[model samples]
Target: MTKSQKWVSFLILSMTCGVIYQVAYIRFVFLGPTARALDVSSQDYANIISVFGIVAMVMYFFGGWFADRLSPKFLVVTALAVTGIADLYLGTVPGYWGILAAHVVMAVAGMGLYWSALVKAIGMLGDSSEQGRLFGFLEGVRGVTSTVVGFVGTAVVAASVAEAAGVLWLIRLYGILCFVYAALVWLFVKGDDRRLAGLGSSTVTLRQLWRAARNRYTWLIGGTVMLMYCFYTTLGYFSPLLEHRYGMAAALVGVIGVVRTYVFQFVAGPAGGVVVDKVTRSTPRFLRWMFAGCALIALSFLVLPRDSAFKWVALALMFALCLLVFASRGVYWAQVGEAGIHPDERGGVIGLASGIAYLPDAFLPTLSAWWIGDPSATPAVPEQGGGYTALFLFLLAVALLGLGLTTLTDRTRRRELAARAAPAGAEAAPLAA
Candidate 1:
């Protein structure tokens, strides 16, 4: 591909991937508005997300299979179209069941079809050596795209006569972008070598997938992914936390959400990618340390005062956590290269890992709802403090678990590399001696 073509493809792929998650991301900023629109309790709203997660977990596996067997262009186009329709439907402010159905469609399109295909296609854009930078750039650009949405959506909502109408407008706007990106992907994303299709007979594909499923590295990495997601997903609650605990306005909290989630991603993604390639030179090693940072940050969240006096301190720590998480996210997939899996098996391995990794989607939202209660309804007072405390404790545990798993993954990859080098080193030693 020409330089221009590569840049175009990268931009399209990144932007498409980024915007596809607005249905979910928008909720982070406008949780109360969404719940009120659905006429459901905050807990019920979280259950809706749990339902989406449950469906998406299943879809993540199938998405991987489709990515391996189908044309990425076709899969992405279909996913974008489906997502667009779902977002438009959601904008109608359908009642609970209607909203639930829309989320299911999003699961099928965004999580199941679009994500793996997007990742696999991105892998094709660069040579093996560039995997870190490529995925990092993907994350950075995704940040940029999502940040654009956050700003625009916040502005739109603030400008609207009613909160519900603003939220609806935001949802519809995302839907329209999906259609636009679907067209761009169809026109601009080209050059499909059979390798990019993940070509193999069905039997071969199944066999490879089975092998990938059995690999310990897959589960370890998947567990690490799950824990990282725990952090990412929980960060959304910080919006409500700030609103209730710090007496911040909803509009101001929304802006903070944008900064914490998307704005930080812009710097973290590319920086993490470059650091992995040039500094640590090992993705898992880099992640191992970052997870340590996550643990420390989570610890701080637990110990720090949630009172108004230390709200800025809490915000500062949250931003630090965002940096670690987004940066780690940018480069975590590079573990595929470090694990020494064949290129052909990328889909199966990624699929299985994703399936395992995203399980929190099914459980975390509901669990968090139970743990944190309605932040809007319940303030974090010293006398009644279990809600936010429980939430922070869980985050700390996830961080510690992730830290351990990433350390093991790093060691395992290093050992495998050393084992492979042993025979070659022996041969060279005899000649040199």
Candidate 2:
């Protein structure tokens, strides 16, 4: 395929993977109506959500290995198809166990089969020089698609006579969209003959896997992602935070959540990419700045008085925080190229990093629930602000740790690059007779 065609295909694949995988849980984060309709307590919901993370953690390692051996095109297509079917089942609004089972299925389809291949495919679309731009555009476009979907889904929920029915309709709509995207992938995403040929002859060895594990840079990158993800997962609490502390209407809070997820992500994702590529021109430097920004924003949450009179100030700060968080998301993966991982080991490295990085997903929900209290509680209670404050303090600490890790990773990467370059220069020198 031509370079242009490959880029276009990669963008589509990235966006499709981003949107479909998250649809099942979108309501848990953004749509209050759906949460109420389900009649599940915050603790129960947290447990349900944690199941995805638990299953995904185990799947990611194997999935990474599969990406090295299997055709990315085929794996991604199957993932979408399986996830679509699972979404359809969820629309039935089964009992708690059934809903939990559906999430487990989604974990297999989305994280296990799809996530590694999707990242590898995007990495393949461009050389090392283009990593930042390609990932940025992929995330930016995905944010746009997610925003559109959220808006449409919200409208459908608002217009319906029954909130439960509206949520069911939304689930069905997502399932249909997943199927359509799956067909698009099958039709447009071509096979990589060269990659496939290499896969056929060579198996991923234990030694190669050990090398990937032993690399200090790999762990540093993974730790960076993990810390940043703690911040991301905490963002889910903002919906209830605004609702409980400031008495924002549920529907309005939902809209605000969408804006945070879609609008901020759309703008920040690409801009973050550009800054990484142009301004910093170094992934570790960009990450250090990004994490520092997150630390500062999170600190604001801790210091600001939680008075209702300061509601607008709180909202503004939250918006700023979202921008930094989403921007960091855009560029964190670009560090893969900067770390000097070989293409052959990219899948395994990403898998190991992502698996460990996202472990917070398993516990953050439960912790958030414990801190924020039940959503069913009356909003007039005076202590709501304290819970959010504690949460912010936790996030501030995580951000600071991320900043330190970024600095360390940068130092290590620089040393590695210099050592690799020195050998080449020495080899090129002419021998005197």
Candidate 3:
């Protein structure tokens, strides 16, 4: 395939994978309908959602290692097929244990097999200079795909006589879509293994894994991602926040939440990439700015009074926050290229970084539940504001921590670059002498 063909095909794969990967969990975060369908307390639902993260966190390392040695085409196909089958089962609305089991399956399929391979594949589509735009387009397209799917699913739910039935229908729709995408991937995502094989070892070594793990830059990048993701995950609570605190209707909240998920990504993902490539010209610098913006936004949440007069202002601020946060996500991975890590070992590096980065998945949901209080709690209490305040403060601190880590990574990278350049200059001087 030509370069253009390959780029388009990879973007489609990225977009499809993005939508399919998150379909199961989307409902849980949608609030009202999901709460009723699962017939569980907010705390119980949080526990169930956290289980996926726990399983995915474990799988990320192994899956990333496997991506280095295996054909991404094969891995992605298998993942999509398995996830599709699990979605079908989940559509049956099984018991809580059954739901938990399905998420475990999803973790294996989505995170273990699909996530690393998908990321590596996108990285391979272009050179280091193009990393920002490549990842940006990938994320932007993904946002568009997710928004479209979310709308359709929400419509299906709204039109149904029974909310649970509607949710089941949405699940089945996602299952079918997964299968379709799997077929497209098998056919169109061509020669990834051969291409990647030229870039790295066919087999991952323990030493390679160690090298990546020992790199301080890797851990710093991981730290940034971890905190950003923690903040991102907390945004789901905004749906409940709007519903409970502002007296927004559940259906409207779901729509707004769905829009929130994709709108920022669609606009900011590619825009952030362009800015990284043209404006900042440095991933680390761009990331610092992104984190600062996130910190400022988080502080806004803390200061906003919960009055009717401030409702629109708060909503607008929340929307802006999402845009900046998701935009940061768009280009943060470009650091993989900027960090000057070997391409051959990138899969393991990605795995190591992701595995560590997603650790918040294990606790953040439960923490959010604790902070936000029970969704079913009748009569709005003063405690809700206090909970939100604490959550915002925690998020603000997380963003600042990300900023600090990025600065360290940037300084280390500059030192490494200077050290390498110094040797080249000394060697050239001797030849001139």
Candidate 4:
């Protein structure tokens, strides 16, 4: 393939893989069934969400190593196929236990290929100057495409006979789609080959991964990612929160979510990326400002009161929150891009970063549910604490935690950076080594 053909194929494949695999972001499937089976409250649902974070942390670690060693096209396509199979399981399997099992399978598949490898693929599509734009575009595609996938998945699963057996049709359909997408990626994609060559290289040894993982900057950013989700978690469940609070139909609430995806993701997310690039370039201390912005994100949630004007104010606050997250997501991953690794190291390091960054996905939902209610319960009835005020407050706390971690990471990173740049550079030797 020509270089241009390869870049386009890489971009297309990366996006297709991202959309197919982002089902985790679409909703918490097992949480609902588990809530039903256990008769638990939303608080318990939050706990279940938290459990996924734990799982994600492990996946991130292995995935990073896998990304470093495997071909991005190969790893990603396999993940799609495996996750699609899991989707089929959810459609056809019986019982709550069966649903939970499917979730587990999908999560495992996600770990085998996503994150670091995906980011590395996008990075290889451009030079340093183009990384921001490429990644920005990918994020936009991620939100838009995943919503489409989620809607289709939900519709197919819903349109079936409403039984495990009937839902098998949906599963089969998605499985076919997933497999087809994966095969297309395998056939057409010509993303970075460095990942393929890196596995045999000695530079990306366990020792290097271990050393990088110990770096203060790594821990700080990783922790920041986990905590950042606390506020972001509100978005994950915003629909249910609406249903529980305003007596809106679950279907209507879902429609609002689609709106959220389209508006901020398509309209606002790219704007945020440009703003971040400009800020990073202009500022002498880039991360310091990034850290400070977290506080503003946290503060945005304070806009609405519980008993006062409902829909508009609440939707507005949520919309603003989405913008903040959309704006910041690319920058969060920029640290990895900026680390200046050998082409080979990018995938592994990206995997490590993703694993560490997503620790909260495992648990954030559980925490959100605690604040909102158990995730497993029947559709939340209206006028409950799971409504606007409660959800916003919870999200606010998450922002605060993210802000704090960002500040800590930035401060320590500066001191270290300065020390390394000092005349006596030995004093500034990598601390985490």
Clashes of each: 0, 0, 0, 21
Off-target runs (Cα >4 Å) in candidate 2 are: 1-15, 65-74, 117-137, 162-164, 186-206, 341-348, 379-386, 413-433
Q: lDDT of all predictions, in order shown?
A: 0.80, 0.76, 0.77, 0.57
| Per-residue C-alpha lDDT of model 3 across residues 249-293, encoded as one tens digit per residue | 667776787778877768877788889999988888888888898
Q: What is the total number of backbone clashes in candidate 4?
A: 21
- Candidate 3: stretches off by over 4 Å: 1-15, 27-29, 64-71, 117-137, 161-164, 183-204, 342-348, 379-386, 415-433
With a 3 Å backbone cut-off (N, CA, C), the pairs that clash in candidate 1 are none
Give candidate 4 regions above 4 Å deviation.
3-8, 28-51, 68-71, 114-137, 150-173, 190-205, 261-263, 266-269, 280-309, 336-356, 374-394, 413-433
Task: List TM-score per model, in order.
Answer: 0.86, 0.83, 0.85, 0.73
Predicted structure with the largest TM-score when compared to the true one: 1
Candidate 2 residue-wise lDDT, 1-433, digit = tens = 7877887687678679556766556744453455555566666767777888788777766676677777778888888888889888887877788778888998888877887778777666666687767776777678778888888877887678986677778788888888888898888876556644443322345665577798776699899999988888777787776776666666677678788878887788778888998898987788888789889988887888756777778788889888888888878988998787888786557656776788998888777777777654765654443577778889989988988898888877776666777777843322211
Count clashing residue pairs in model 2: 0
Better of 1 and 2 by lDDT: 1
lDDT of 4 by residue, 83-149 (tens): 8877666555445555556566676677547655666666666666876677667766766666666
Q: Which has the higher TM-score value, candidate number 2 or candidate number 4?
A: 2
True lDDT of residue 391, candidate 1:
85
Model 1 lDDT tens row, 1-433: 7778877988899999778898765777787776775577888888999999999888765766677678778889999999999999888877889988999999888867888788778877776687768876787788888888888888988898887678888889999999999999999986447446443322225666698888887898788888898888777888877778766777887788888878877888778988998998888788888989998987888888768788888888888988998898777877887788887786678767877888888888888877777777755334233687788888888888887888788777766666777878732222210
